[model samples]
Target: MTSGMAEDHRKPPMRDLLADAAFELFEEKGFEQTTVDDIVARAGVGRRSFFRYFPSKEDVVFPDHERCLDDMVAFLKTAADGTDLVEHACEATLLVARMYAERPERSLMRYRHIRDVPALRDHEHIVIRRYEHALAAFLREGFAFRPDGPLHAEIIAAAASAAHNHAVRTWLRNGATTDAVAAARTALASVRAAWGAPPTPAEPDDYVVVITRSRAPLQDVLHHVEHALARIAPADDAE
Candidate 1:
């Protein structure tokens, strides 16, 4: 017999089967009353098989989330040089939004179930934190920010993730017909505006040397000129 067959021929990949079965049972009898054994029986699998794939019945509802997070991290890591970090982060966030949006019905069902359950809501928060941590790591590495660098990058990551989460939750609440991708883009725009634009290149010095008056203090005049230049110069020019 083939290794795959020898290892476990009781059913197909137990995770997927259990997930489908769990969703069906949840839909039929509601999430609160469903049990792990019930899901395994519906999937034609054993209790051991179900436990091997998922720790609890609640987990069957969130299939492939770890894979999705891994994919997002991989996508961000492979971003080309010269791509804006914020833009790259936004794209990564969009990738996640698309993953959920791709299976709108399943996503919506999971969202609804999670909102009504305290344990699921807490688990979802943990997942959200993982994504935020991954994005913040990317930002810190990509920008070469100091360990204690300005909280700007971390703040941006939090805002971006929160925005994406809000968009997805709102879409689910609206029956999942709304364009979540567009809503995500709108949310990311708010994050971008919060972060503002990238740094501009320094301009070449072009100030003319002016001779000073004999009666005026040179220090005072120089200070006044410096302040004026600061106010009048473009950020790039000042840089």
Candidate 2:
């Protein structure tokens, strides 16, 4: 009655009941066959509560990503004020990888489920693009004064997204043999190093500098980064 652990009658939270029921249904009856009604019946909940918790059936597969995305954007915004935008953006994207890493078995199951369902695959892309856009938008705001801010911002954001995805896939494919968090960090570090970022520096370090003799195109600055990175041999391949 006190809403403490001793409350044996305390029903399993509706959210968990729904999620557990939905996943079990997906496994038993298959995702396509498991309707919202089926899930609600199993959980002993009603239609309205289901909608309150999730927007769609596919959402049940990865319920925490939306919260993780919100947390990531908050992290980027908090670090944007006179902080290293690139590093922060890179670090922020790790929330996705970490979310999955925190529950490797569930993550793997969801990954396989998504692979089997084309609709979920498409939905996954939308989710990933949102994170990329959020990172880019934050970088754009932070680098507003720079002449080539928008271009650089987009590139860095894309790189961060790619790093997180690559790390997560590697962890899953490797039989989850590596520490997922460490794998995620290493992937991000490789991206940072490729862009001449100091690997896990104690303090922020400037990697790219934008200087133009005239109103040059953004591509010119990007080209300089290409040449600079090409000059140095890469030590890690997002391992």
Candidate 3:
């Protein structure tokens, strides 16, 4: 009988070879012009080996996405119990951003290709949704006692994912500069700012004693007051 260890050794890193070959072919011939047989031929691997590595040619664009997502989930699971949920979700998203930044050129090429391809775009959307769902689950577990726990968790997850995507897309469109990670962090900061303060209670009994007048519109003034109150209020008190 053949030993399992021997068989594993004989596999010859087929997955990485196939993926590298597929990406090269896609870059050369365009995604629509590339075929599974062409990828296998370039890789010097069998068609069966190609299938064993990935279900289809399109999957080569994100060969390690599932693994990266699993890594994010594992990282999230290790976060402290009393950590801020939004901050934790942002940290999880940063893991994904770092994965892309690690291969900025390849990621930029894939991003450009995916944008023009309907199928790849759909696949990208599904992958992002999966990330969001994983983050939402983590947040829900972390903040179980919060009012509207699931909804709040989902909102934070969506915001974090959106921030990451926006940053990556911006980086790709701008020629994959070294500042991509910084841009991603900045985008995450915007999301954090959006959700940072808790909502303040509207005081119907209190008179709005405005001591000063500005050139700003009435709506702007009201908005500023609301934001100030939100900043001053305790989070749990607002809850």
Candidate 4:
């Protein structure tokens, strides 16, 4: 048992080994040029261990989102009822940004690689959608009584993800500095403010019916509706 304990400490965890190997290979051979076999060969791990940690090559480019998302879900579940859901969602989504901001070089590398590669970009979107879906699901439970609750939840979830992504992209494109994280926080805060506001009334449908006097003629009703619309609609400035 003592020898086994020593052996366990002797080797780096397979997950870390695979990640390090993957990034090193990505940097050396370019993301497109690297293969799973190449990464495993560099890390001295088997193919089985590689799959256990990451589902695809692109997964290696990003942090362990599986765990991060689980953490976010847990964080949300424990949130107090008094906390504004929108603000809490924004803060939770920032965790994703912080995961990247903590490792600037790796984050920048992954960001660039994803931008250059369409497949990786698609994969990244799928991961982001997972976060949005999870957030929406949590919010739906919180707002189950309302008719438009699900839609509102989805809107907030999408907004949260968009804000985080925008900040991370801005940071990567400009320069990966400490200022980047601050930029990310500011951007996330903006989303919380903009989307967190009271939702605007939905646009009217075509051919709306306006109730008036029972004896009112069709022409009078039409005029009433038109006048009401004109009052609400923006004035056209065109000459």
How well is each residue in 24-115 modelled by candidate 3, as lDDT tens digits?
98889999899999999998867887676688777888887878899998988888855666777887888888888888878888988898
Lowest lDDT 10-residue stretch of candidate 2 = 1-10
Model 2: per-residue Cα lDDT at residue 74: 86
Query: Cα-based RMSD of the predictions, in order?
Result: 7.1, 10.9, 8.3, 10.4
What is the C-alpha lDDT profile of model 1 across 76-167, one tens digit per residue? 88878777788889878988788888889889878878878888888888878988998988887776755654376788789899989888
| C-alpha local distance difference test of each model | 0.80, 0.79, 0.80, 0.78
lDDT score for residue 19 of model 2: 81
- Write candidate 4's Cα lDDT for 1-239 as tens digits: 12223336567766667888888888788899999999999998678777877888888886568878988898888769667778778778777777777778887788878878999999999988888888898888877877999998888788778877888888788777766656767887767777664543576432344679978898988889888766655443232
List clashing residue pairs in candidate 1: none
Native-to-model Cα distance after best TM-score fit, residue 230 in candidate 1, in Å:
17
> What value does the lDDT take at residue 212 in candidate 2?
63
What are the TM-scores, per candidate, against the unseen true structure? Answer: 0.75, 0.75, 0.76, 0.75
Q: Candidate 2's residue-wise lDDT over 53-124, tens digit each?
A: 789998887778788889988888787354667778888887887788777777777777887999999988
Residue 132 in candidate 4, Cα distance off native in Å: 1.1
State the weakest 10-residue window (summed lDDT) of model 1.
1-10
Q: Report the Cα lDDT for residue 50, model 1.
A: 78
